[model samples]
Target chain A: MLDVTKAKIIHDFAHDRPLLACRYDPKERFVVTSSEDYRLQKFSLPGGEKTILPEAHNSWVHALGLSPDGQILYSGGCDGKLVFWNIADAEVKPLRTLDAHQGWLRTLSVSPDGSLVATGGNDKTVKVWNTQTGELVKQWQGHAKNVYSVQFMPDGKRILSGDLGGAVQLRSLDADDIKGNFEAKPLHTYEGGQMVDFGGVRCLAVRPSSDQFAAGGLHKATNPLGAVHEPLALRFAFEGNQLLKSHVSEGITGGGLWRVQWLSDGTLMGVSGGSSGGFLIFWNDQQDKDFSKFKLPALARDMDLSTNGLNVVTAHHDGHVRITRLSES
Target chain B: MKCPYACGSTEHLMARRKFLSLSASGAVGVAGGLGLLTRGAAAEQVQQKQQRIVVFNMHGGLSQLESWDPKPGTRTGGPFRAIPTSVPGLHISELLPYTAQQMHHLCLFRGVNTSEDDHGKGAYMMMTGRRQTPAADYPEIGAVAAKTLMPEDSSLPGHIRVVPHGGGGRGSDAAYLGPKYSSIHLGNGNPPQYTKRPDGITDEAERRRQEFRRKSDRRFLDGRRTAMTDVFTYSFEQADRLMEQRDVFDVTKEPTQDQEKYGTHDFGRHCLLARRLIERGISFVQVSHSNYDTHNENFDFHLEQVGEFDRPFATFVADLAERGLLDQTLIVVLSEFGRTPNINLYLGRDHWSKAWSVLAGGAKLARGAVLGATNAEGTEVVDIQVDHAQLFHTYLQAVGVDTSASFQIDGRELPIADPSAEPIWTAIA
Candidate 1:
């Protein structure tokens, strides 16, 4: 009898350690997480009150990006560093730490006119930088492993990344061009499973209005490191980039799909649970029905659809910082 | 032959007593001289400094009438009452007066039995000590201690999961230890900015771009090698030792009188950043404190959830025993199965997994006392029972690990604590 109602725990940041990647703040009123205790915090959304940037970064802060003019914030760490914060006065300082990569910066992409950023690491290289001049503007270096999702393609001159060999590559923010048009790609590529068998291409989203995208795999060398043969994909994009309708959502027999979003009325919201009852679902706009679910209290990793679309922040794996409420009807 | 020249000051005092009898007969040969400064002050008064597991996940199950198997004056013990603690026969539930003044460092474990009363298989059998596989997928003991203690090199992150969302059954993994032994998830820890350094960038261009990416990664590894050459040379030496200790996640360099004794909450600044990430060595950290799937009001919702766990858990166990760090830190509260020794009809309690309770104290557990028991109709475990592989071998023998170790998988040889249950070693200490 509860579709989604009790909202008032606001922000329970417990983490003796288990919060991996979370982002929000294009006005969802602050929420940023990434840990294994190397730190990167900032929470206020719906009054969870926490503001200790802890000097922003040094390690383990893997992937974060908010600058669509939310006044800068881009992190990506595990000491391949790369920080760029300034969320206004609560500043823990770090306009640039760019250790640039030898490994572990894993994925970040910002450029819907925030003036370029891009990043991807475990050092197979994919940087771009320049967020209004902290420099290091171009460097793509064809992935051979470790790139794990990057995206800019809302047409800021293309860029999509996804590696560790599941291949998604697209590049070209031009520095006199450096190879990576690998032919109008990732309109769809879900061959994840075996080939070194660790399952890569973990996440990718793109659908604020619709070119209709979504990708998530994760199964890094089995036993359960985020397993997935195909946990979620959606595709869509018509007219020459081809790939009209692709859908894929029923294979969730036990925790796998890392993340996938798309809700602006085009509706697609997501969150795949694990350890058995991790729901959140949403889907409408007929992506094959099933328009509701809420049960979660664990493992909901990365969700955001609130520039006032009636909040939905989420970033879990037991760090519990939810917001919920996309629609009741 | 010595007798012939014997007069040179008695052969230089018999060669200075044979060089002081060969330096006291090589006393275990310089075991690092002076016994390594008295074994580094006897491992600094018995090696402690690494203990972190702040779970507290009361996610959706809260009634033994109100807390701790209470049966009160019976009729299925609804209204709540039972008080008294600090240890004498451990009473509990005057709606937990600050956990009855820290019940002598809590142990509880009121005999929890299980059958998965659904919250998705009872929160995936209480955060993955195991059960819920349909083919692979088992990695949640904080993703197996973030795949056994996170430091394969350490750019910090051998397992961290604050505000975690899914770490139970299908996937909350680092399972066969990939995704580089996963876990570094914070999608939310109040506002640690998803892990920080998103914009203000200035530790001198983050230490001159980490000394220009360690001189362009030593000139691009001067002649590469692949298959992730030892995971890219141990992730570039843990990304240059996590870019020179990124100020150990700087809680504003602490001391606003220790952030007002960690109680302004967001789970008390994630338990004071999990005691500064286990005093900076990070082996496994898991600050969950979630929704507690409460089915209904259930005694004014546990009198405001047991006063939000009695003052941030008695100020995070007296701030880890005033920084000596609670005998190596273990903490644990736990919940995903407990509630309803009958109360329902809408007052709510529901999901009872046979018997329920789990409190656990710091690292070397077995402290003070209490192991298992239940009866007086709390439901089951009539005596000693403990499951979840004996609570993951009593949390791997309270940290000294070695639950028979092993690992290999898919070709056999498992162990790493699962040897089909054993470690209740009376709760180990």
Candidate 2:
């Protein structure tokens, strides 16, 4: 159902500063992005009209999510604040802002029903909040390091959070923390030479209509201080929480895989950034190596797919949000 | 000869060769009474200037935005937040929670513009307080302090560098002041080999052998007491004294709580050893905590590095203050330069010398003081800009050395510091 080999850049919305992530409105009318410039950017679809959203967070905002109806956009920032905006408004502003975490709120995942939002960050905690009232509903702790990636299971009954040390834990919505653990040790590297702990779980994705999920990160850090590392991904079976396969690059010198997603046909797509620049890699379920790959003009920090399964948006370090058409019209 | 309880590592072998060489006599023998004429006249009376100096050399370019002068909430501020310190109105990066409580004993010079970006040249400027010119070379601060403050009766080497890597050896940074004042590199804070008699050699036998050697040397030198023989004798006598004080190198001798206060990691152990050496009256101790050149993932690396550096460094400062040593010691924390405020593509900060900060305390420095100021974005100094020359003068003057005085060397009088620059008077009590 997906043909990544035929992908081509459809448009580029320049922001003039490094961007971290982008998300398309399910309605396909506009797209919003978060960047290191400490603000959010909106670009109207087809017309490519660029608009600067009202400054909601005091620091670089990196995480974004949208309601199922695409009316409410939730953004999280390094300032530890989470804010909501009415995406349908002509002049959108922060409808409500909540102090979500202690510091550097890094990742957020919205429930399939669009009622709850889960967040994780440098504070080493996972939090869930009510989207309507902006009230914190639950707080999960046990991570020894920064929490970098978070996601809600499609069933809406559980959530998964990953940390800088590459530990992935699955938690349930009804009871206490930590339902199960998945092995992802290949992504952790404690560099003794510089006394730096390198690598982290960067992104997570679950296959539609299946019982498997994947986490992307870095492995075999050669020179961590210089960011010399290789990209890696692990797919796990939901039955025993056992690892199924470890996806790796051919020979790309990189920092790590920043974001990953499962296609309609269960094909895995990953975006890599680092010394060799950025690349889009496509992989099959049964193999550890990529089946095909595409090169990007610059390193990408985050990636999001359009609802139609034909288009994808990537946040680039070269100060542009590029929309790539993954299939020929 | 080996340390009586030696581990027999090849490092000890290299150390023995370096420390026992004739050139190293000047490095180990600050108490060589015959060498006093080559010292700085301004500080000739070491008894009156029993002052000490300690430097925490943060190697590589430490990002000012993530440490001393945080510009949080600004475009160039990066991710980490700035938290309040012990001193009222003083704030530093949140990465240094342990160090925040010890800020009362510290002062910051925020508007430093050394203008050198290369690592080697910037390090030379910071440690030696002068630009690297082709015509002239200068000694590091450790060498200067050793020659100026080491008492004639002191038994230990005056200048010591506790490095976490490499083997024990002597540095060659004394420049025109001669090799005798060079800093001794104590790898992992351990002294060189031969610090103890072998298992079979009794003390009485050792004393008798030493006496016999002295007698033989006296007879041979009756007509040939030359510079070479004098240097050799000085080296031998000092080596014996160091062996007697080898117990100071064993950090495990400290209280369990004290060792635990500083983490048991390599940097912590090295810092503890530096403390012992200073408490034992060493004139200058340099502790290196390195590899801060974060060209990628600067925030993550700082979180690890600055977090590791926070507790032990603060504990050391607090201990010095409680022991009354703060009144006589000049302590400083510095690096080659500061990182750029502009975040790069990889979220890394590049080498930036336009505006940075340095931390200093102890001796005559005003406690809880902040000197100079950076603009809101930290791109430039808005007030009280000072360079390395001024910083060098501040260091020596804080320890009671007269900045206007000169050191007499081979019939030539060299000014102790750059004559064109002066210390930030406001920072001095």
Candidate 3:
């Protein structure tokens, strides 16, 4: 039997604004949380003391991305600049800041090889920057709406970017013209909007080794039966080509499904809200259709599956980190 | 090799002249000739053809009873009257006076039946002319037309779909053709976005940049002339030229009279653009019109929609005929399915896939006629049954495509059109 069980929160720390997103380092030694309170916190593993980076950003840090090598951290806020942090250095100062985006940056995705970082913003553009040189190498300029999330393929050959229009556009980075203003032509586009019946893609995450990925967000629909249809959905895409399946969760009344992440082991994780209140759910693909959902205890603002696959963590709206393990039979 | 069916008709003969003119107008590079020569082989099946297909996808389910199959003076017939069209005895909804006036130029299929009521699945069935698959999705008709009919040498896109898939959260999409054949969506219909060049890039500067890129691409290709050799090379060259003429999407440069005739509505303007694209030798263009889902106030809603649709559709058909392009341009008006014959208490129509309607005009469709008919209540097809498969077969046949043709997929020999379907000869020229 396969099951997921969330443990009790070890430490509780509250923030004025909700914790919008969270991430873990490759080694699982540290956890990072970005909040709408305009602050980022770096916490030691297994619920130790946390160090808040109060001077990190000016506005709400809506997005956070870690380089594949775990050497650098990229964060974007409502202020529209992508700040890169050198993870190895004791002094946490932004190594570089990209201010070319016209609107608030919504997502940041680092290539698996740690060579490229793709940033999508509310300006309806996705721009790729060379991690080492900070040069804008490619720009995807076609989406008519704000972009929400971006994920690079495991092999670093291609990348996927999602927009507010519910499109998952796969863009290829030209190898020959590394700095020659490579145009991002979409290789695949998913109607993430249709799958969830939602407004658009709120978040997306690619699996570690496979082309399979997950997209999660809120959905809204007008039912002919006089009932409105609303739900949170995890749409799975295989080979970055098409959406294979969709798992619907309870809908949020006011807030929506804000974050979605996949572990190296291919388990999906995300936050959802309902009448019973907000909860974190771990999706085990191996679960039978009848028994698929496992809700966490607290109101998780965001959640992440560890790269090591041994632990799962949740960033609570109450400002606490809940670390838990999966109990498999 | 010449197409065996080529009788040097006005269409085929005129197409040849236009093709020659287009090739000559862009004769700056020797590469252009090579692209055209290679394009010759890929398009051998289509001959030296320049046919266009404009698909007006009426998103949401349009009711056959309310629009095309009116049961006038019957209980099922809502509060609406049938108006006589320009073609004697042919009548359509009073709501569509404009379309009625131009009815001589249109053809209606009123007996279409399907099993899928879900918007997503129905859309897939309509676009691909096949049932939805659990494993492998199929390419849409536009994608297939782009593959089979579009000239590989054309500088414009072979298939252009201006609306986002399925018209905003309706689950409409290009299923299996992969992203390569996906549409360059013109974003929302609110105000066409993504149609402008970046600021600070002067025309001279832009041309210089393109020239530089071309030089760089040429030098790069010359260095690996032996390594990278295949149909991809030809595709890339065509894509390069398409990038140059990207401004073809702009409607601002069109004549004031023409733009005004197309109207200021998004759908109307998009229809004009679709015609413009087809004129430029594009094989397929889909213009999506939205908000046809009339779950409430059915009669009132359809009245408004048909009102908006009437003038533009008539104007488009007239414009096509005026340009002498109607004979070679197939205009298809399609939707997912029809609404319920019985109006609900909310004065609404629910989803019904049993019987509906689709309109075909231009190309070889018999003009000034309505094919097939529904029962008295407009609830089911009682005369000349035209299922979705047969409708698709008739459409392909009217466009000069062989409906009986077959293709191999996963080791199985599959007919392109449904095997059980027979093309409706009455609807085809």
Candidate 4:
């Protein structure tokens, strides 16, 4: 089991601005990050050497995906363009670029076998593309609002997407119709006083050892524009899209967790930000509250767990890409 | 590209020619445009008889990056996309698609740098067209319009403000403009509070009471009459007349189809009421849609708040145009200031007064014109930059009011708009 009490920060790589997304190289060579400055950068694992890539996006890049074989990387940006990069290229430049959406592209997920990539956008669309050719395999526009999160299921035959209205729709690769929809209503709010709908499914994680998944967001938005709310995560059964448990905690006051991941030991981890500062909270399926937690240096926008499950990397607004060792020093 | 629809109409061309001809002549000079109001009474009469203005105050700081001056594909543009409008190449954020369809009737004045980031100060500058100074207090445009456009025989109060969520009261924003032109707040689509007569008093009883009060007022003021007393009497009579026609403020009486078209939200109802007042011949109507401060979750709130704002605003404009009020009415969409171009750590934008946009339309103003430009990243205005004073002059000038002229008040000649800034000439018809 992952021991939250033993986790300690081993490295804090400072950058110029807030980082939005972070991912570990499959070969354990480096860690990649996209940030508020619209730059994609890589930090070497041991030495913490930094390499800033050439300009590939004119806007903030929010989603990054590495192929299973670890040779290719795909980045989706608020500019709605998706760019492909060869990881081993001495001169790091875009290999191919596609104008993938009508508006901001928010999230992208590489399929289990790395044959396809699924992406979501502010255009209320979920699109699947052939990874090798960068050809759009199929595109669907069914969300009532902006699509904030999307993920390819472990089976590779299905995909799930979440929207601004807190709707999680399940779909099949072979069909155009929706297989099912799980309404994560607690993760959404239509604040009448402000006449605004705030909060959405911000992040999603699939349990590695079980047929279950979790969606992370915020609720109780008494004042959404003011950033008043609490963090909420819902665990669901993958078989019928049944909601099984709701994980919540106290003393948030404001802000929410936007990134989540499943740990090797079946613990669920989420990185939160906003007025509540930054925190990493862990939960188990049997409990309705977090089992353990650790505070972050500042607000964390995104987080990732390495394949080896020993290092936890968090992207923070303090301009630090922090690496936390999960085991004893 | 210049909009084809606004300029192509045969009647519009004739009007445009007449407008242009007048704009060049000494007989139709605006105060700020031609340096002085030398046209005498002909222009003053036209200004009094023809002009109307509706102001939409997007309370709190609205995000220019998400509304008028979208920099989609840029780092600071957030996650919204900019979409094309009816005005050919002019585009706004997708959050305002409904408003985009009405863009042909409006001009995007994209280069506004008011330079006042504080809420109270910025609001004062935008509304009165002057910097806030301890030495001077200026009336907002609404009060100015109400006083300037008052018909000789009309008892109806010309200034009205519609807010759907607050308690109604008479506003004191008139400043030096006097209480006679102050705004009567219409709260929550309900008519001015206490417009209805008490059950205990019949019409005859009310008439008798009013007659007695007027007689007492005349007798008491006969020896000690003052300017303040006259102002009070005039305001009371206006209020009495409004009570008789109070049903006009009840928006539920509007057609169900009309109500549905504007949406059922608070902002929507307020917009409907604004249109109703405009159609009722009120010279100045201000409707506010608010809570756009957006210190966090900027995208989500804008997606919702701007969405709520879009349909109602468009419907108000289209309905006025359909009713032939567009020719005489000036519509202004304004805010205290705009949110920053920088996307902060909370995914929110801070106060940015350096560069932004304001939407102006109708009256005799130029249609389908883009008055200014912001660079690709929207960090600054790259062309035709104008400030609040210039905008104030432009709005007054659009209604044929000479911004250079002074209002003769209490033996003092107070200049109407700021003398330091002139109207935006390119925005005029």
- Candidate 3 stretches with Cα past 4 Å from truth are A1-329, B1-49, B164-180, B188-196, B201-243, B406-415
**How well does model 3 score by local distance difference test?**
0.64
Interface RMSD for model 3 amounts to 20.3
Q: Which residue pairs in candidate 3 have backbone atoms (N, alpha carbon, C) closer than 3 angstroms, thus clashing?
A: A13-A319, A198-A219, B166-B172
For model 3, state the Cα shift of residue A213 in Å.
57
**Considering lDDT, which of the candidate structures 1 and 4 is the better prediction for this target?**
4
Candidate 3 chain A vs. true chain A: TM-score? 0.79
**lDDT by residue for model 3 over B81-116, one digit each (tens)?**
677889898777767788888778888887788878
lDDT string for model 2 (A1-329, tens) is 46888888898888877888888898888889987767888899977788899887888888999998889999998889999999867989999999999878999999999999999998999999999898888898978899999999999878999998989999998878588898777888887677678888888898886498899988979788787888898999989888999999887886589889987777899988887888888889879998888888899888888888778888899888888888766
Residue B198, candidate 2: alpha-carbon lDDT: 85
Candidate 4: how close is chain B to the reference, as a TM-score?
0.89
* Candidate 1 DockQ vs. native: 0.01
Interface RMSD after interface superposition, each candidate: 19.9, 1.8, 20.3, 2.9
Top-TM-score candidate index:
2
Tens-digit lDDT string for candidate 2 (B1-429): 211211233433333344335233546442455345355567753447479999999888888999999998788888778899999999999888888998899889999999999999999999888899999888899988887887766777888888877588788887766566788788876775567778899999889987897678668756654434554666677677877888877788988889998889878987888888888888999999977889888887887788889999998999999999898888999999999998887888889898999999998899999999999999999999999999999998888888778876645678888889998888899
Model 4 preserves the real interface contacts to a fraction of: 0.58
Stretch of 10 with least lDDT, candidate 1 chain B: B33-42
